[model samples]
Target: MRGRDEDVISGRIVEVEAYRGLEDGASHARFGRTQRNAVMFGPPGIAYVYLVYGMHHCLNVVTEVEGHPAALLVRAIEPIAGAEWMRAARIAWLASHAGNRSAVAIARGRDRLIAAPVTQLASGPGLICAAFGIDARDNGTDLCDPNSMLRLEPAPSEEPPPEIACGPRVSIGYAAEPWLSMPWRCWMKGSPALSRPGPKAAGTGGTDSARIEGTEPQ
Candidate 1:
């Protein structure tokens, strides 16, 4: 992403969750397209940013053909560059979120953001948005456009691709049986940047559908 001043920040996406509209019970477009989810129904390679918990922003990439409404939620990313800028942005967000705009509080937040491991700087979907200053304003952006402020890029091929693992999506207690239990979430194996280190497979534990955490309606 490039800030207004041309400050660029970049990261490698490490985890994602696929959502198939209407057919997928956990998808935002399960009920068909609305004003909020219109981007998902557009052409492929568009951004579908949304706010969750009234504050945190989550980013998704639209996939499939027009009107298909398929997307991949960017669940986690590994920060690659612009550490200082990311720290400042994250600290500003943390301070604003806490409603503690005091200098001391902001300083403390900056310290924490700076001290955090680079892999964790943009680890979660929300954290990545905060660190890179992405939000609803970026929704519907053409992610395939090279000139876009927040655009997707091919990964550098100097290193081998990391092995990937698949597991059930997280915090979707309201979704029905098949969708709720589907192993649609993919992540790089052994990546410490994942929001949750160990993904729970279906039948590994109880199907207690009452434990939704850190999530709102899709």
Candidate 2:
């Protein structure tokens, strides 16, 4: 979720990528602790927001208890509310970056060879952040806090998690070796919000949920 004060942006997370420290070459914390990655070294349930390519802010969920540099990069989300703000934000971002062609395409509903729909607004990581107004300022945010401006709530469904599929992460050729091939990414079976998609390896079934690490919801 993102908001200035009263206008909150909300969505349902649908895709994510996992990074494990000391073993995952593509992870920022693979080398060692630093000021930039300190959040990842902290407790789980926090938002590890960071900018990539100087253009987008990617939101990650810290995990593996305290002092462990592990995170799940939130890849895509299905818009739940405040879609108008998301559309305006994307257009504004494009215009600011001198992306006239794309902006015009977006304006004319001609980009991606078709009109981009509201649900597709946050289909990618950068777009997700952009759509929700998430930026570097939201780094280290405690997503578990009920009082926090940004937090994760239960999905509209009361049922268990959807069928899951695992696959290799996106665009990390620079990492080399197995890190590039590790299938740490998972998503809801065939969500349209996935940044990328591929075959699936079925894994029985289980509930997928998040926690603040304090009090469980009753």
C-alpha positional error of residue 9 in candidate 2 after TM-score superposition, expressed in Å: 2.4
Q: What TM-score would each prediction reach against the true structure?
A: 0.84, 0.81
Taking the tens digit of each residue's C-alpha lDDT, what string does model 1 give over 1-218? 55433467888889999898677999999889899999899999999999999999999999879978889999988777786778778888887787647878777777877789878888888998988999899998999898898889888788798867677888999999889988788888768788877445524544422232433243
Question: Candidate 2, 211: how far from true, in Å?
Answer: 22
Positional deviation of residue 63's Cα in model 2 after best superposition, in angstroms: 1.2
* Candidate 2: regions farther than 4 A off: 3-6, 99-114, 200-218
lDDT of 2 by residue, 1-218 (tens): 65544687788888889888766798989888888888998999999999889888899989768877899999989887788778877866665666546656665643441346787888899988877778888888888887777777676587687866666778887797778877777777667767764353424533332212332221
lDDT of 1: 0.82
Clashing pairs in 2: none
Clashes in each model (backbone N, CA, C under 3 Å)? Answer: 0, 0
